[model samples]
Target: IAVMTVLLIVVGLTACGKSTAQDLQSNKWYPNQKGQSYKTQFNKKTMIIESPLMNVNANYSVSNTSGKEYLKVNTDDEKNQKLELTQISDGYKAKAINKPAKADDGLGSFE
Candidate 1:
């Protein structure tokens, strides 16, 4: 009887976890992860989310279309500073043209 009860509890927990995961997936902020459609672009290669918390994430990608490689931008990115792409020889690389973050400017600045 005890073993059966434990198994039932485990199954219930698993079901709850799955439901929570589904809820997160329904959120608009969540990244689109459907069939290689998670491509995103940003002006600084890093996006700063204001609400909830100060979250930062980098988004970029490159793909060849009709013998021409094109860089795509994320719709969630800000409209003020549109992400620009530059072509290179072989493949694509994300480059940082802006100065480094002031918080990380110095090694001992935190001290």
Candidate 2:
């Protein structure tokens, strides 16, 4: 019984953690301040700006009248900083911008 309880607790915690992460990703935007622009198209008639340059490492799941889309900015240590762009229109456009990695004293890692 004790073992079962512990396992349940672990699974619950893991599930909660994943849920939190998804929420964060869905709403990740740093330069989320006012007046900055980050525009991506939802279709021919709709354009959405999930965040701004100030939103340095924000992730977002954008849904518009057309469809759903995802965006995430890369900021992991040991990896190059880049703007991870993703869009799915008639086809799709996905790419990254390469930039020099920053020094963080070896205490951080990118994912």
Candidate 3:
């Protein structure tokens, strides 16, 4: 019984440890802020920002620093732009970090 219990616990923890990359690839993400008309689709290492005007491509990565997770989006004009997310009922509320200000900080919701 002891061995079985330990095995179950290990399995449960492993299942809950889903990588952010896997979550990003699951669905297209929408913005939760105002005046932003773009959605994002994620590949293995890239994010496609789809807008009415044009589609922009960028690289992205997920990292954990000091027990907090951050999503880093890199574009032509920006590099290693970090966003901290708080999980809500339906999605994540993103806040821009390591910046003075941001207009793109919003919720990352999937449909």
TM-scores, one per candidate? 0.23, 0.27, 0.74
- Cα displacement (angstroms), candidate 2, residue 59, comes to 10
Question: Cα-based RMSD of the predictions, in order?
Answer: 17.2, 14.1, 4.0
- Which of the predicted structures, 2 or 3, would earn the higher TM-score when compared with the native? 3
Per-candidate count of clashing residue pairs (backbone under 3 Å)? 1, 8, 0
Model 1 shows how many backbone clashes?
Answer: 1
**Mind giving the per-residue lDDT tens digits that candidate 1 earns over 15-34?**
67633223323333323222
Which ranges in model 3 have alpha carbons more than 4 Å from their true place?
1-4, 7-12, 35-37, 100-111
Judging by TM-score, tell me the better candidate of 1 and 2. Answer: 2
lDDT of 3 at 24: 73
The model with the greatest lDDT is 3
Residue 106 of model 3: what lDDT?
A: 23
What is each predicted model's overall lDDT from 0 to 1?
Answer: 0.34, 0.35, 0.70
**Model 2 global lDDT (CA atoms, 0 to 1):** 0.35
The segments of candidate 1 whose C-alpha lies over 4 angstroms from its true place after superposition are 19-21, 30-111
Question: By TM-score, how accurate is candidate 3?
Answer: 0.74
**Judged by TM-score, which candidate is best?**
3
Model 1 TM-score? 0.23
